[model samples]
Target: MASQADRVAEAHKTLYDQGLAVRTDVTGADHVHRSLQNGSSDFARPMQELATEVGWGSIWTRPGLDRKTRSLLNIAMLCALNRMTELAVHVRGAVNNGASEIEIRETLIQVAGYCGLPAGLEGVRVAERVLDAIREQQSGEKSSTAA
Candidate 1:
């Protein structure tokens, strides 16, 4: 049998591959690649590896909920938890998973009522930034294609 560290390494790779596939499918290859490379410290690297194994491998890969549903749930939960940074990332994920801006707006409104005005406001701000970035990317792509 593999050692604990070895097992974790294998699991992390498997989960990262699976999660990256889903993430890339939703957010596009460029965005997902950029997000995964956001951290570079030794500590950050190990923590990311561990998170990939547990968060993606253990939970996100589980049966029942599809990636779209999971993305929405993640947005809501991150908003409630006051995790703006993660919320921003999931906003992009939500879009990749086929969520419209209107749907995201509605969800934020609902979040405000349940999670408090402050959290809801922050979530909306983060969502706006992510949406803007997506639009910019899309337009850039269109321009490049047209050129």
Candidate 2:
């Protein structure tokens, strides 16, 4: 059997390949590692380790689901679970993975109709932030090219 650490490393690598790894600027592997290894009593280490391994590593690593589908699934899950904070992160990730503004807006609109206005509103806010980042990046690229 794979050692526990080896399993975790494999999971991290898988998530990285699928663009689902928590970035250094985001959750960083070190923080995730620490949390998995030595989180508070309320935070079960074994379960957390499994989550980092299987959840982030295996499921996220599969090539079957593209980023767009993953984003949609994340939005639905977030709405269902009332996980707005993580929803926002997924929104940004969706944009980084090439989801168009219209697609995101449509997803949010659908969520609003079914989930509730609050969820939709939060999704919109996240979408706006992601869109702004994309626009800024585009502008920066243009300016750099012209210089």
RMSD of each: 2.7, 5.5
Task: Give a tens-digit lDDT track for model 2, residues 96-119.
Answer: 566777877888888888888887
Q: Evaluate model 2: give its TM-score.
A: 0.63
Best by lDDT: 1
- List per-prediction Cα lDDT, in the order shown: 0.81, 0.68
Compared with the true structure, what per-residue lDDT tens digits does model 1 show for residues 22-136?
5557557776566558755775776665655567666777999987788888888999999898888789988878888988888888899998999899999999999998899
Off by over 4 Å in 1: 1-13, 23-38
Pull out the clashing pairs in model 2.
none
Q: Candidate 2, which segments miss by more than 4 Å at Cα?
A: 1-51
